[model samples]
Target: MKLSDFKEGALGGVPIALGYLSVSFAYGIMAAGGGIDPLSAVLISMTNLTSAGQLAGTQLIIDGATYFQIAVTTLVINLRYMLMSLSLSQRIDPKMSTGERLLVSYGITDEIFAVAYQREKAPNTPYMLGLISLPYVGWTLGTLLGATAGNILPERLCSALGIAIYGMFVAIVIPQCRKSHPCLVVVAVAAALSCLLKYVPVLSSVPTGWAIIICTVAASVLGAVLYPEEVDEV
Candidate 1:
């Protein structure tokens, strides 16, 4: 709650919030395209919070998928968060209660995980809490506002801003690429593999769902094997 803590959270969250807003705006339009109500889109953004999972779940809903399919799909897309939460567990004060951890887990995302992992000082609980709060609010509100203001905005502008999310991803990736040759190799290999999947005939039909799983698992394994963390770095 301190101003200093809030400032840090805001600084950490600004890039994430901007990226989230653009991506969520796209999601809003996609939800509308699928004939979902604006309120439902907002609810999806707030509750699911994971962009890939929500889009997958929405597609499932549009397809009239069975409950089992939807449930499995959601779990598959979000399973990475389990790993993220575990990594973050070691970073938190051990004295924090189960309930507090559960609450914080709701805001766990890749950007938040990256920021938390890089912290040199033990994060104040309030600052960590703030890290999630403002970004979550921005994500939810941006989706809702985008949906409510649907297509009234120019199409070209929306399409251009959509690139901002990808740009944000590149911003994260480029720094790590500079830090190590292995990181650059991992990204290059992943991008090449993705292109093959996108272009090649038989593999082209692979759903976005499975593509993410393949890319994430392959890249994580490759990264660990090629660039194992040094024990003394801690």
Candidate 2:
């Protein structure tokens, strides 16, 4: 836990923290509106550290979805984190022990992964901790505020804040699409599949989790088939 490493990681996390504040705030408001108390909403943010998963899970809870449905929905949405962690394993110090890997793995969100992957050095435990710390705090704080005070905010404003997470995602993906044709194609395929699943009558019946999983796998496969060499280069 070198001070320098931690500091650098914390600095890298600032933007992510800022982005999380708005998104989590939106989550908090939604949770509060859905009958989850402030403490419970904050607890969910603290423990989960994910945007989409929490939002979906909260909605399910509000809808009185069965436990199995909630678990499967959240799991399906978050399965990508496993793949992200695996990709990170390649860039991290190979000597990292199981415990350190587990701890570091807790912080492996899409935004955090993007920042860490860009680092020139192999990210260490301390660095990863520092990177995740602020975002975690921001998430919790935002949820607290939203759960407690969000009702005072107008509906239109709340709606606007809720889209911050999506904007963050677009920010992450657009640059990659510009850099690589394969990446662009894969993203396109995934988006198209998602739209089809959401809109087409037959596919619309499929569960959200399964639809997302299908899109992710199918898009990657099609991209690889179309650009085997490019995929291999990555």
Candidate 3:
């Protein structure tokens, strides 16, 4: 929790924040276009920092979805947070207060989790706090500005930027998958199942949120069972 540790964490986190800021800008424009208020857009980016869940939730809102549907969809889309939280909890100081844990949890995201987990030594509480704060600030500010200027952007340009966030997701996930056979299998299975669900008669009407949950869970479980971590030969 020392000042030097906090500065180091911020330095470590700068690259991640820069990448996230760009993706979040697109999310802000989408949220605004979907009728979310500017403040709400900023809040979502600041609190959730989850592009897919935010996009799904915002579209559901624009479609006049029931409150229950929005809640369920968001939970399904964000289920991975549970795993990330569990991993991060292990890295945090054992003496850390529950309140500190709760506050840091708000900033958990794929990129943040990856960087934190990869660190050789666990980050101190102050460092984690600073790491979270910098990106959260960028996300909030980007969302506020994007929402305010959403209408002024040309439609084609906005659409292209919107696609960039998904590209970022692919860029992160694909490299990790390439390095692990089990991960590759899981991704392939999920893609196949998703495609089938989209084209099959009865499943075609299933809620996309539910379909994604089912596919992801099934694939991950299969991957874990079929490809348990390799052990070196004696």
Candidate 4:
């Protein structure tokens, strides 16, 4: 609960907050274009804190998909968060209470997890709270701005900004891929599988959410099998 710890956490989260703002802005545009109101879109960002899940869910809503479909699709797309949460649990200060841990879990996005996990020791509750706060606010505000802008912005401009989310993803992964052969392989395999799923006759009929799940799992397993690292040595 130290002020210094909280300040450090907030400072560490600034980059992540900036990234979330750009990405969530794109999500807001997409949501608004699909007929979601600004408030609803902002609320979705506040509650979900997931890019893929929110985007897929918004698309499903536009398509008039059943509740069951929305639930399953979101669950499939967000299954990685389960593993992230488990990993983060091991990195949280053991003195944190159950309630505090649950609160911290809400902020455990991929970027946050990466930063928190790299710390020399487990992150205490105050640090985690500070880290999550700014990003959460940024994401919610970005969605609000995007949604409001989507309603008034020119069609061409909105269309152009639609690519922002993908661009962000590329920005995140390309550096790591360049540094690691295994990472590159995984990305390539996932891209190829995604393309195949989009083009192949039978597979093309599968929902986009399922396609993503299959591609991610298949490529990840392939990468793990191909590059079994020496864990103890590391």
Per lDDT, the best of the predicted structures is 2
Question: For candidate 2, lDDT tens digit of each residue in 93-169?
Answer: 78889999988898889889989988999998888989999999989999999998888999888778767767767
lDDT of the structure predicted as candidate 1: 0.76
Candidate 3 lDDT tens digits, 39-93: 8888777666787888778777787877887888889778878888887888877
List TM-score per model, in order: 0.75, 0.82, 0.86, 0.87
Pitting candidate 2 against candidate 4, the one with the higher lDDT is: 2
lDDT of each: 0.76, 0.86, 0.79, 0.86
1-234: candidate 1 lDDT, tens digit per residue: 477875786688877787787778877877776788899999999998877788779877876777776787788768868888887788876776778777778888987777867877665566677787767877887788677775787888766755554575688689878877777888888887778778899997876555655766787678788778721231
Give the TM-score ranking, best first.
4, 3, 2, 1
> In every candidate, how many clashes are there?
0, 0, 0, 0
Q: Which residue pairs in model 1 clash with each other?
A: none
Ranked by lDDT from best down, the candidates are 2, 4, 3, 1
Better of 2 and 3 by lDDT: 2
Candidate 1 residue spans exceeding 4 A from truth = 1-19, 52-80, 114-121, 222-234
Error of 3 at 21 (Å): 1.4
RMSD of 1: 3.7
Give stretches of model 2 more than 4 Å off. 201-203, 232-234
